[model samples]
Target: MTMSITELEQALRALRLSGMSATMQARALQVAQHQMDFLEAFSWLVQDELDRRRSRLLDRRFTLSGLRERKDLKDFDWTYNARLPKREVLALGTLQFLDAKEDLLMIGPPGTGKSHCAKALALLAVQRGYTVLYREAHQLIEDLAEAR
Candidate 1:
């Protein structure tokens, strides 16, 4: 017996396959249009579920990271500060220090993109499956004091 789309979606939801359930209607339309075969449709459904789970995991990580902005290193204005060590900043973006288990300290005068760069790097680290805690120097000191 063929299952109705609603029944199928209900079953998928029961199985906690939210991603597949969410895409099932669209995939069904594609199937009806002969745009996808059974195997292809099944693969797409599985991929959708995986993508949803991955996205959710990233979201949770970002929430736990205490990062307010979704910053990227590419958005930094290299031309604005010609004296900035572009090479070093780019190297930090590579995240080698993470593997080396080292800490970073970005010190510069006000309005020199210190916080911007740090936030960008922290965002990258969170995206790359790392847990991060972002805080300003004074905030860190306050947290330390509060802990004592």
Candidate 2:
């Protein structure tokens, strides 16, 4: 037997597919408007669910990262930071270093945007599905020493 829309929505919710459940009604209209076939409509629903899950996972990672502040690469003041390696700094956003087992250390005197860059990269790593435990260098060393 075919399931009614309400039953289908309930089943989706029970399965924790809230994204599909919430968007199914609106997506159904899109399917009709676009004259989509069954497979096309189903694909749309699945894509929406996947995108929503990715967004939610990113948010959760950001929360768990314990970052003092949220920062974006685009928000950095490029104009004022002319001497800074803009290309190199922005390249960190690609997050290739983690894959290569590279650790980034930004050393500079205080007030040279060190904290800003560190926090921003940490945010990128978390958003890119990497588990990050953000801790100050001093704090991490202290913890390690105490553990020993």
Candidate 3:
């Protein structure tokens, strides 16, 4: 009562196991020739599915995030704005306040990295699998006014 590889592949495809079905032939060959265990081969196929799903999810998140460019919190230079509290800015990167349903305000004079920091935080939120909508201060105010 053994199933042929073609039958198994068809069954896997019918079950929507594209990742497993696509790699099944090569993986099965590896298992037979390299003495790889069934569990190991199965896990690799599962990992491929998981990785693909995760990447697609991340892409969707980025597209909906309204982020024009990727910003890195680590790239921020603390030396330029010595007066700015570095710890406070870095703490925002952790995004704990998001869980508590809190809002953050970044206020500073021009050329003080306020926008950079805000964008960096937005990037962090997006990377952490949170929905982010970024808008300029004036743009946000205008939207609010229109809503009124």
Cα lDDT tens digits, model 3, 73-146, are: 78989899899888988988889999889999888789999888999999888878899999888989999999
Query: Rank order by TM-score, top first?
Result: 1, 2, 3
lDDT of 2 by residue, 41-100 (tens): 889899989999999998888888879689887788777656778889988888899999
Clash count for each candidate, listed in order shown: 0, 0, 0
Residue 38, candidate 1: how far off, in angstroms? Answer: 0.4
Candidate 3 clash pair list: none
Write candidate 1's Cα lDDT for 1-148 as tens digits: 9998899999999999999999999988888899999889989999999999999999999999888889888999988888889899988998999999999999978888888899999998998999999999899999999999
Best by TM-score: 1
True-structure RMSD, every candidate: 1.3, 2.4, 3.1
In candidate 1, residue 7 scores what lDDT? 96
Whichever of 1 and 3 has more TM-score, that candidate is 1
Candidate 1 residue 37 Cα shift, in angstroms, is: 0.8
Estimate the lDDT of model 1: 0.93
Worst 10 residues of 1 by lDDT: 107-116
Stretches off by above 4 angstroms in model 3 are 1-29, 145-148
